[model samples]
Target chain A: MMRVEEKLFQNRYRVDGARAHIEIVDGDVCAVHCQDKPCTFCCPAGCYAMDNGGRVTVITDGCLECGTCRVICGEHRNVRWEYPRGGYGILFKFG
Target chain B: MSEHFDAIVVGAGPAGNSAAYTLAKAGLKVLQIERGEYSGSKNVQGAILYSDALEKIMPDFRDDAPLERHVVEQRMWILDDESYIGGTYRSANFSKPPYNRYTIIRSQFDRWFSKKVRDAGALVVCETTVLDLHMDGRRVVGVRTDRDNGSVYADVVILADGVNSLLARKAGFHGELKPKDVALAVKEIHFLPEQTIEERFSVKGTEGVVIEMAGRITQGMVGTGFLYTNKESVTIGIGCLLSDFKKSGIAPYALLEQMKAHPAIRPLLDGGEMKEYTAHLIPEGGYNAIPAIYGDGWLMVGDAGMFVNAVHREGSNLAMTTGRIAAETIIDLKARGKPMTARHLAAYRKALDGTFVMKDMKKYRDVPAVMDKNRQFFTDYPHLVSQAARTILTVDGVDKKTKERAIRKEFARTRSTLGLFADAFKLWRAFE
Candidate 1:
């Protein structure tokens, strides 16, 4: 019954300040389309969620880099997914 | 700086390590690249190592590998919510030396395997990702890495870049992986005192138990849950097709928490500290989803090649076996002074087809499709069967014949008599 935040807190990451390795290619794609917003549900790290503004929002700092968001986008294919720069992103202590 | 090699291998998971180790031992100038900070920093698994795979790669691997515990018992469970109908296989033979399987932690195991690859004479480079494949016309000639002036040339490149395999996609070796063909699995490891684990799991030194569960835990998704006992920690996780998760709209972590809270599963991790949470994708599409594995001067191995045998929950073995075969193919061609053209590289696929790796995949080739189409197999059957088992086992003064009739009625309520027979036929054919 631990929170996703607490579970992610247990992991280690090398944060890249400039940009997230993954992004919604266009915010309008989520605003006008993607009613289910599967990324919100499938991402294990809880990096994606819907905001009050009727838009999908993401925070990549806690991202586990699982690539779920990349593929879950389905028809939209709006996520411009890339691995974080080498040496960055979640580093599993135990894997 | 750009450099050339006899071959370039991408990714450092089991597949890449096996390929590199074999190529290196064969005296090929191999450069193995990894995107993780270290060899296994990006890898995760429920992590049961089939000793046959590792032993084939390095015969004496047991002498120094960081294995968690050798498995002596395996439990398969069919659960509805609270109770489970389970079958257990325990063997004193499994407990003896030259064990068949062992629990492992990927980060530790990959590091050790990478070390072995290096010792075998391959150049293992970490913290460097292969961004793209450098192609000469249509043939893969080398790889372009993330480093400054990182373009390196080689006669052939082996793509062992795990399940995500962006490089393979970029090169158009295969199109986008259908969500239906892949599964998203999330797992967590809980730390406990070694003695506590030994006593709770009812095992002695280095002996482990594995539990594989299927039923309401996945909430009707086409998937299964597993728990593997490591030396001092327990690894537990559930996986379902991506398409199912998208349709179900269930948060994966929430699913994990709910599964851990299951009455039958909770006590196994009582008082343990959860240290890490990890998520990974498994190629579950069986033989039909396996893409073009070898073409031109390139070949695919491991998850990238979709060599997983989902029926047996075997990916790493297929990964290692595929990697080994690919390496052997390259070694044979090099020794024969042959080029790694698609025709020659066809040997890799041909040779793999002769092994259990491809044979098992072909055997269960229809499983994913059958499993995907049959929702009742996951939801209704588990509930009804468990209910029927309870009905038959509990003596409430009901006549034996009446109990049998009741169970039959319950089963008939779920499916028609013809439909039930057809379901059995579909299952038999799927596994045929």
Candidate 2:
């Protein structure tokens, strides 16, 4: 099985290096509120992860723009999700 | 001062393009806005183009469309852990000209569609995000874009925005989408040589095959998987309900990995190199979960209205049909000098109800709920059915009747007789 990063490598993206389209409103919400960090698992791109320091971080570069992370995080409602700026983020080669 | 148009169509996917094309061809001033770099840059689907729908919109589309392959065969599979029981339908009639359906890559197909929209005289703009709806009190009048001084008024605003339309929710048009209402799907397109594709799929020049699968692959989730063949590539993917993924704690990508590893599936993609992987949400809420489709100056088409018939795995057709009908409704209303008000726009819903869009949705309205409650259908049934197949087919010393009785006993033991009967009734009612 290919790693998610390896899988995403085949796709194209014009990254908005400075601006993150998806934001974790509260970094500690996952540690304090969530029993199971669903976003880390449910995100198709595997964009969100809780590191060894007990902090949840989101990388927007590989984001599929699917909006799954926000919906599945109903418990904390901490994902401030939005589409990237026009012409940025994912560009499907053979969508 | 912002310019006012006859109609503002949002999103450049199938639905939006359909509306903009129809209105433009009717000589109405139309502005079609898309957030992508190009028409299909942000869209993805299993993407089987039902010619009937597009034919109604543009009768001669086949002459110049960016089609991949025409479908001549369809396979429906019920997969177990290692084996699958399925049926195939291949028809020579489907091989004839004016093909019933064709496989398409959404990005290229959408570019072609937007070209048609522009050629029809609709003003198609890309790389511009529609931030919100411009409303007078509760009635939508136009759209607010991300651009400076981007407020543009239109007599009718068609929301062909895709499933994750924040505009629909922010404008108080619909409530937040429930987890069960949407399925999160991940698909990868594998590139193979044209000859290799044709040889593997047992098809020749421009012919394609589509395999829709169910049972076990979704890991007991109320979802399905699919594999579609293109001219030189094959697209394979799996999807489950958002709620199911949350509960099962299954990683979305991991599910696809398991599906790709299936014995019945893996061999076909033996040497193909994957070129693109994508993930998107599908509106699977069916008829009952559909929001207020038409109100005041706005109409919601495509997945925005939850128009997908998940039972048949058909969405683009519904999107195209709803879009065309909505545009037609607006054109008719304008011809009669009727205002695009809530009362007048009810015709759009009426038009849809009279078409297969609403009728098919209504017929399978109970499907989502049935699949939601019946976890056994995705789990136990596959094992039971496969076990029965293995038992009845193997040349054992046992007699045929004895094997049949053993199969029945196994079913009764796995799911009590009463439970089995109730399950059958539920399935019947859901499909009925």
Candidate 3:
């Protein structure tokens, strides 16, 4: 099976290197409220993760802009989600 | 400083393009803005284009539209772990000219559609996100974009921005989308030689086949998987409710990988090079989940209004139809010298109610809820059905009557007779 990252690598993106479109509004919310951190698993782009230090991190570079993390994080409402500014995110070549 | 137009359209997907095209063609001053680099760059679909909708907008679309294939066959599969038992509907009539549906790649199709909108005199600006609606009290006066001096005024704003319509929510048009309201779909386009695809799918020329699968493929989730044959590529994907994925803790890509490895699906994609991987949200909430579609000086179309008929797996058609209807409502109101108020724009909703967009949505309103509660249809039932097929087809040397009894027993084991009846009744009520 291809890793989620391998699959995401097939997509095109004009990454907004200096900024992230999706932000964890409260990282502590994931730690205290969500034991599983659903976004860490449910995100199609594999953008959410737990670091070695047990901190939640969201790398928005490969976000397919599917809005999964935002909607899945409904209980905590932790994701400050927005579409990437203009043409700065994943660009689907064959969408 | 601000620029104003007769109408401003947000998001250049099917819905936005349809609204922009219709309004511009009717001689309205229209400005359509897209956050993608181009019209379809951010868009994706299983992509069965309903010609009737486009025909209503541009009757000559067949002339140069970048259509991949006309669907002449449709296969519905009920899959188990390693086998599928389903039916195929193929017709010579569908193979004839003036097709009813055609497979499309959104990137190519949307670019062509935006071109038509531009040719109709609509100003289509890409790479510009509408940050928010410029509201004066409850009335939307214009939109604030990411660009400098990006506040653009309009008599009316149409929000065609796909499912994640943050602008609509920011403008307080709707609350945050419930997980049950939208589906997270992941798709990959596999490239194959044209002749190879033709021989494999039993299609020639522009003919195509669409395979819709349900059952274990989604890991018992209330979702489906599909494969559509394009000219030289096969579009394969799977999606489940966001709530389902959350509950199952199944990564979307993993579900897709399992589906591709299914015996029934593996051969179809053999030797195909996957070139694109995409994931997007599809509003599957049906009728009950539809939000405020129209308000003072603004209207919502497409997935923003939750127009997807998940029952039929038909979204682009509804999106285009709603967009066109919304545009027509605006055009009619403009012609009558009426303001684009909530009262006047009620015509858009009323117009949609008269079309299949609302009718189909209303008809299948109960389906999603029913399916959500009924797990057997996605899990045990598929297994039972496939087992029955295998039992009946395999030469076990058992008598026909005994085999029939065994099949009944298998079904009864999965769902009791009363449970079976109730499930059937539930499905009947949902579909009815």
Candidate 4:
């Protein structure tokens, strides 16, 4: 009877740096001034944030590794992606 | 003789863990292999774990599982640009002990389940990818890994390696998933003070709310959006059929952005700090999309076999349930001294059919197609509904009868009488 909503908050995996690996390459942040900063709006985790100057910065650590940015970047080629090394990334408690 | 196990289960998510744990508990020598550093490391979900499924495997899960908040309420919204019409269902029974569903972060949950698998006496090796199935003509006997001397034999191989299970495809068990049968989803977790989350969501300790959305959120694309309240963060996401993305030419992120900026949605996350963003594909092929699930020496479970109930946003439970059933079937077969063969393994399908997994999926089998063919439901209906609601709810001097007439006219303007009747009938039939 465990419903779908209750499991959203359980952080079952702690990012032990040894297993979870993420690297942000240079020029990966989308620089496009498209009417809507899609990444800024679309990322569920809000990993991509737009500053007052309209530049987008990403803090990779908090990433759940859902792969949205890669697809949404839309051939922008601003993001280089790979799985977090071995054991580090968003671990699901119930998923 | 060789480094042989009773079973080798690949991937350590719900399905893998369930299979591994069940087998190990039954005193089978099991080896669960994971490519990620740990279980759940490579997983993501707006995850709501079904207790009925897990309780069948681990009855005491509630006592020690890393559970987030027990959801006491659910909201389904049909959204337009700035308005949504939806109903909220909240029940105090959900807050009671032996709570039904809880929100979970995939990374943490999988690790916890993996620990249980190990505790149940399985040998779990992480950070290793299973490169190929060691096949003897038509039968799989073992797996070869990337590391040296990494080949291991087993009596049965369980493919729980997730959505894009390359091993299954390589073994020619299934082909590449079709675009229409899959959905690409993106989600983010925003960190907020626990107190703030509690206050904003109008909940006490460890209580949560989940909102599932449709309509303009997907911009005529066949997709949905979701927001779930956690203990200290909110998980929000949007997903659509891959075919929708290809045809619409609008990025998934754009849909997500619009969903987040929704006036009804924005207030909930006003001051929260954004945390993580990620995306993954979900297998939504339903009953028709399931591939060959078993062979002479192997069986498939979880996303590998595409056991996702997209209508209910129920994938992990299906994964776990299917995994458990697969394990149970193997146990029963072993007890009967039957060899693992496709014919014998079809029992797994029979079990699934008797359960909600297949039943519910079959119930909604035509929904995805119906929605896809009817783009007006996503585009025009929400706007019309919202405008009608606005007109009705407005406190202007219009008479009640006039307001009702205006609402009727609004519906007619967007959808002719026949169109409205057809939509209603289609909806009724689709659910029926």
True contacts kept of 1: 0.74
Q: Supply the DockQ value of model 4.
A: 0.18
Prediction 1 global C-alpha lDDT: 0.91
Candidate 2's residue-wise lDDT over B1-432, tens digit each? 288899999999899999999999999999999989999999999989999999999999988999999999999999999999989999999999989999999999999999999999998888888889999998899998877788899998999989988888889888888889999999999999999998899999999999999998998898999999998899999999999999999988899999999999999898999999999999998999999999989999998899899999899999999999999999999999999999999999988999999999999999999999989999999889998999999997999999999999999999999999999999999998
Which ten contiguous residues of candidate 1 chain A have the minimum total lDDT? A65-74
* Candidate 4 deviant stretches above 4 angstroms: A1-95
* Model 3 Cα lDDT, one tens digit per residue, A14-76: 999878888888777877777778898899988888987567999998888888888888788
What local lDDT does model 4 show for residue B245? 74
Candidate 2 chain B: worst-modelled 10 consecutive residues by lDDT: B144-153
lDDT of 1 by residue, A1-95 (tens): 78899998888889989868888889999988878888887899999888887699889999887788888885898999888888888899888
lDDT of 1 by residue, B1-432 (tens): 477898899999999999999999999999999889999999988899999998998999999999999999999999899889989999999998999999999999999999999999998888887889888889999988889988998999999998888988998888888899999999999999999999988899999999999999999888999999999899999999999998998888998999999999999989999999999988898899989999888999999989899989999999999999999999999999999999999999999989999889999988999999999999999999899889989989999899999888888878888889999999999877
**iRMS values for every prediction:** 0.9, 0.8, 0.8, 7.5
Clashing pairs in 2: A95-B106
Per-candidate interface DockQ score = 0.81, 0.85, 0.88, 0.18
Per residue, candidate 2 scores C-alpha lDDT tens digits across A1-95 of 88898999999999999789999998888878788888888999999888887788999999999889878886678989888877889988888
- Sort every candidate by DockQ, greatest first: 3, 2, 1, 4
Q: After superposition, how far is residue B352 of candidate 3 from its true place, in Å?
A: 1.0
- For every model in order, the TM-score on chain A comes to 0.95, 0.94, 0.92, 0.68
TM-score of 2: 0.98
Put the candidates in lDDT order, highest first: 2, 3, 1, 4
Q: What is the C-alpha local distance difference test score of candidate 3? A: 0.92
- What value does the lDDT take at residue B13 in candidate 2? 89
Docking class of 2: high
